[model samples]
Target: MLGIAAAVLFFIAFLINAADIATNDTFTSTNVMLIGLTVLALHVSGVGTGWGSRGRRR
Candidate 1:
């Protein structure tokens, strides 16, 4: 799920940067790319993979 989210963010960043779209300071392409990287890192680190709950006994 998160991987998909990251992919979408990357795509959006690419479009923004490649198309030369004008954006506000907060939503710049660089910022979107950075946020995507952060999300990817979190996904790689198992932050939201649901592994922890699966091991719990009912």
Candidate 2:
């Protein structure tokens, strides 16, 4: 529940940042992609994001 909400929030913010960057012609950065990749990494690793942890004894 909490991880999904955090992911959703990150996604929404990423979209807004992308849109904001699209409106500007002088933009020369990969901030949006970095944000997206960060999200992906978090989702994949499931490390401390409320997602399932690997190698747990429980």
Candidate 3:
């Protein structure tokens, strides 16, 4: 559940950034690349890779 929440937050951040880019039309390539990388990293590390072990008892 924590991972899911983190993933959702990450996605919301990405959406906001995308909206900013769409409205301003002045966002740089570096900014876009960085945001993409951040989203990918968060998805893979926060949700995709760590999904299965999140709710188990030790």
lDDT of 2 by residue, 1-58 (tens): 4356456656766676766645343332354445555766766666556535456678
Worst 10 residues of 1 by lDDT: 49-58
Per-candidate Cα RMSD to the true structure, in Å, reads: 2.2, 5.7, 6.9
For candidate 1, the TM-score is 0.87
Candidate 1, residue 37: the lDDT equals 96
How far off is model 3, as Cα RMSD? 6.9
The whole-model lDDT of each prediction reads: 0.92, 0.56, 0.57
Query: Which stretches of model 2 miss by more than 4 angstroms?
Result: 21-58
Give one digit per residue, the lDDT tens place, for model 1 in 1-58: 7888999999999999999999999989999999999999999988889777556688
- Candidate 3 lDDT tens digits, 8-43: 555655775666644344445445455656666666
Say which candidate scores most in TM-score: 1
TM-scores, one per candidate: 0.87, 0.36, 0.36
Candidate 3 overall lDDT versus native: 0.57
C-alpha-based local distance difference test score of model 1: 0.92
Off by over 4 Å in 1: 53-58
